[model samples]
Target: MFAQIRWRLLLSYLTVFTSILVIFAAGVRLLFARSLTQQLTDRLTALGQGAATNAEFDNGRLKVESDFIVQQLIHKNQGLEWFNLNQKSILKQGNIGLNLPLSLSKSPIQFSNKNFNIQAVVVPIISNDNGKIIGYIRVSQSLEEVDETLTKLDLILGSSIIIALIFSGFSGVILTRQAMQPIEESFQRLKQFTADASHELRSPLMAIKSNAAVALKYPEKMRKSDVEKFQAIVSAANQMTHLTEDLLLLARSEKKCDRRENSVNLTAILSNLLSLYQPEATAKEIDLKSETGEDMYLLGNAGQLTRLFANLIENALHYTLSGGTVEVTANLVRSYLIVSVQDTGAGIAPEHIKLVFERFWRADESRSYWKGGSGLGLAIAKTIAQNHGGSITLTSQVGVGSCFTVRLPSVKISDNSQD
Candidate 1:
């Protein structure tokens, strides 16, 4: 249980760490991208403004000075295009094309082609004499280098996040284990106390029950009221004894231990249990029967296995209505033996299914009390199945019946060998 808790804690830590790292990386990437884009846009706007300075209207036609174009060609990736006020291209310089359209808007407008993305700004040339629009200058640059730099930044951030997560995963395991140590110690101490207390109470409980039984054996010597009092004492002691025994079993089962024992035949065990329960079924007028294969064997303690199935059977019989069916079936599938106890009973609600195996959890509380159930039967059965490297599952509906299936790893034996 502590191991399971540690794993869950470590997973939660890693999940939260990964989320924060991803968000931080994304924020860094977004800010860096925006800063680089802003720098490109500013450079384009400045170049377009400078080109607009050298513009002049000659004979109502726009023209740009040759000196400005020559000086601006030093920039390798930069491009420029000039257009007359009529929106016709006047000149193309550097790497820009004449096919580029004129833009009256002062802000940068982005364009993309098969080769690369372009960031451009348009500057409208106003006549110095009359302040009338004369021409337009478009300055642009390719975004290849900026894209390459950002790609490299992405790679670096991604690799860093992965490495950090790998390291954090290792540390998370250690941290979660350290964190759970106190809780684990406390749980172990509680189990020890329960085992010790249950063991200590057994003798006194049995003695009280025995003394009450002996006193009741000679009922004529006592008044009728005293006889009733002794009978009540015997019943109370028996209940306490059963409760203590269950508590002790649960406490012991919680301790990790190897459970492999002698080979046990499941078929014979179920047969015996069926015979034992047959009289109760007859009295209740319920149909209790077994449909099982022969010589189904598993490596486990015979007593524990018997107790596991007995609990299931008793639980089924207790809930089932008179004339309802309780069927115990066993079948071999692959290397596992599947045994199921199905009952046509007052089926458990869907919400209560998960709580069925919890210690002292009863679906029908008042009915279980009247039926003398301590509410630990299913829990004990689950513990025993888990100890033997098996699992038990339940399937039920409210109006239909319920099935409790136990799947255990089966063993094969030769004819000459004795179990």
Candidate 2:
């Protein structure tokens, strides 16, 4: 359980962190790419304008002046290439070299190859007298610097993400362990208390039973009323025994453990339990009925299911007054088996319905021992349902009765021969 909790915490942290990292990386790449492209385009435009101004029309022949322009066009170790419209190589700057075609009619093209990107611009130069194009200039710039900067940025971002993930993973595991410590301690304490309490209670109960038996041994010397009182003492001790057992069972159920799986016939279990309780219902003048669909099969522990039903039925019997009705019904609903126990008893208040299933929580503080309840019945039933991948819900009104429903995944029979 602790391992599962830790893993879940780690996964949650990683999911959130990775999502933000991905968004940040994408945004940075896009913004940097846009900024670099704009800077390159601006530089190319400036170079093209300067070159156009330096070229002059002298007797119908283009004469390029300006020593600075000539020097820039021939500079070595720089990344710039230039070509004239007549497909003749003009001035070339930088170590990078390129070949030009004479009959070029295409416009400027910007393309990236491998790690280096190139931006080419074509500009037309006009004649001095008319608006006719004398020639065109093409300039290209290399994007090696931008590529290197972006690569460094990517490394920094990746490193930061890795460091953050390591820190978060460590923190998540520590926090998960700390959070579960109290829960583990509580479970241990509860288990030890149940064991010690059960053992302590058994001694007194056995003594009482022994004393009652001894009193009956000298029945001839005792009054009829005295013998009857002793019998009542024995009966009360037995009831206490039952209550202790139920309490222990509830405590064990609360501790998480795998339940044994077996094929359970809901209809059979309900029918048998109902039959066993029929006499009690008749004696109390209450109507008890069972409505079960044919062969409702489920996969769960049979013992837990029996106990679940017993507790619900017993609770219904205890609250319902004489001449009231208690009903038990089971059927298959789609992929689930639904069982409902309803009674015409003093129904739970709307506000208390949610708390009724909590351990040792009783709505009536003045509930008597004669009812033979320890207030753990509903809690046990809930735990059993949950362990079986199911749930229990309650609906009640103050004056009207209450209905407790249990829904569990149903097992499909290979053949529907027996409906």
Candidate 3:
């Protein structure tokens, strides 16, 4: 149970951490790509404008006069090329014609080929007077740099997720162990108490039973009052026997040492349990009913399930008054098998509702002696549900009634059924 809780905590942490990291990584990648693309485009546009402005039409040839400007443009823009309108490259260096368009068009043209990590943008240099096409200035840049940056970002994000998962997993295990330590210690103490209490009660109970038997054997010599006293002793001893049995059951439940898997027909089990409890309900004049779905099978310990339901039903019967109703329903809903026990009894108080499931907790202190309850019923039920990868919850109103619902994952009928 502690391990399960810890795993759930770890998974929750992982989900949240992965979600945030993925969103952040995507955002960063998008911004970086956009910024880089825009910077490249702006630089290309500026160079194209410069080339147009610096063009000088002398006779029939266009001449670029500024040596400093040409050197700056070529050196700074390493991967860009300048080309003429006749599909001829002017700059012979740095892979030129890759950007120059095949068709003569005035509009800016952009193209990319991811195989080579190459991107190209071409713009025509138009004459200012007649708006006629003069020459073309093409700009191209390698996407290798961008790819490298993104790869690094991926590595960083991946490493962070792995590190966080490791740390959280370790922390979750430690925290879970610490949290369960007190509970384990409490259970140990409870076990010792049960053993001691049982041993202490046994001697007195045996003595009483033995004396009662001796008196019965010599009934002729005993007075009527003495017989009556012996009968009372026998009755008390019987009650003590029942109490000891309940205590042992509770102790075994607390230990939770048994874990065997077996296929069990849940519907059949519920039906049988309802049948067994019917007589008790009739004695109290409380209506006990069972509604089970068809062929609801699951893999679990039948003994544990029986104990779980017995505790719940017994508690319900104990609390409920005559003419009240107790209902048990089982059904398969989606992937879960749900079992609900509802009772129209002296409903739990709002304040005591939460504490009712705790060990040795009783809402009605006045009826504690009459009920003959050790107050470990609901706790045992809860433990059983959890052991089966299930959960139990309660809802109650003071004047109305209380409902205890248990939901467990459905299992196949063909699976191992040793439990």
Candidate 4:
């Protein structure tokens, strides 16, 4: 159980940490890309404005002087284009290795060409004399270096996230173990107390029951009131004895041990249990039946498996009304041996179904207690099923009936092995 808890804690920690890393990485990438692009746009806009100054309208036609100012604008990894107001490119400078449309923006506008991996900006030239639009200047630069740097940053961030998650996984395991230590210790102490208390109570309870039985055996020598009182004593002692036995069984079941070496004949076990309960069913006028094939086998402790099914059958019979039916069936479905104890009884309520297997929990507490049930029968049965690498489930309707099904891994037994 603690192992499962530790793994869950580690998985949750890794999930939260990974999400934070991803969000942080995305934010960092966006900010860095925006800053780099802004720097590039600013440089391009400055160059375009400077080059636009040298451009003049001659005879109502735009012309740019190829002087040092325009030449300086066409630096390494940069290009320039001057277009007239008619949106026609008249001059190109340096290596503008992309076929792009003329820029017609009145203000500095930045754009990119994915095919050429380039960033560029356009600025409209205004006449200094009359403040009329005359021409446009476009400046461009390669984005190969910027893209390379971003890619490197992405790689580093991804690697760091992976490393950090690995470290957090280790740290989470240690932290969960430390957190679980006290709870585990407390559980061990409680289990030990139960086992010890149950063991200590057994002697007194048995002695009381036996002495009461001995006293009742000689009814001739005792008053009628004394006889009834002794009978009640015997009954109470029996109930307490059963309760302590159940508690001790549950306490001992917590130990992790292998019980798979013994091969139990499931068919024989069921047949014997049905026979044992046949008298009680007959007394109640209940139609108790069994539908099972021969030679069903499973690997488990026979006594424990017997007790597991006995609890189900007994509980079924206890709740069943006179003239009702209780059926026990066993079959091999695929690799599992399916056993069901179905009873046509006052079925469980939907709301109380989940709490049925909780130790000391009863759907109708007063009635269940009066009926001589310790309320740990189903809980012990569930524990036994789980310990044997099996499971038990219930399906019921309030007005109809209840079916308790047990699924255990089936095993094949040869004739020689059985012999």
Evaluate all candidate structures by whole-model CA lDDT and list the values in order.
0.85, 0.76, 0.73, 0.85
The top-ranked prediction according to lDDT is: 1
TM-scores for candidates 1 onward, in order: 0.89, 0.56, 0.54, 0.78
RMSD (Cα, Å) for all candidates, in order, is 2.9, 10.8, 10.1, 4.5
- Prediction 1 TM-score vs. true: 0.89
**1-419 in candidate 4: lDDT tens per residue?**
57778788788888988999999999999999999988888888887787888888899899788564435544557888888988788988866544778755544444567544787788888888888889887788888778899999999999999999888888888898999899989989999999999999999998999899999999999999999999999989989999999999888775753655678898998999999999999999999999998779887778788889999999999988889999999989999999999998888888888888999987773135236889899998998898888899999888688999999988888621441
Tens digit per residue, CA lDDT, model 1, 67-138: 664445636578788888788887888875536567777677878967988788888888888998898888
lDDT of 4: 0.85
Q: Compose the digit string of candidate 3's lDDT tens values, residues 1-419.
A: 55666678667767887788778878877888778777766766775676566565556555555333435534543344556667676663344337434545434344566354655556676777778777765655566666687788778877877787788778877876787789877968878899679767878888888888888788789898888888888888887876776677666655554444467678877888888989999999999988886887776778888888888888788878899999999888898999999999767777887887787777664245345666667888888887777899989887678899999888766665533
Off by over 4 Å in 4: 65-121, 128-148, 211-233, 279-289, 319-327, 342-355, 364-371, 393-403, 415-419
Pairs of residues clashing in candidate 2: 78-94, 87-102
How many pairs of residues in model 2 come into backbone collision?
A: 2
Error (Å) of candidate 3 at residue 246 is 2.6
- Predict model 2's lDDT versus the native: 0.76
Per-residue alpha-carbon lDDT of model 2 for 76-98, expressed as tens digits?
Answer: 21234344445455555554444
TM-score, predicted candidate 3 vs. hidden true structure:
0.54
Q: Give the total clashing residue pairs for model 3.
A: 4
Among all candidates shown, the one with the greatest TM-score: 1
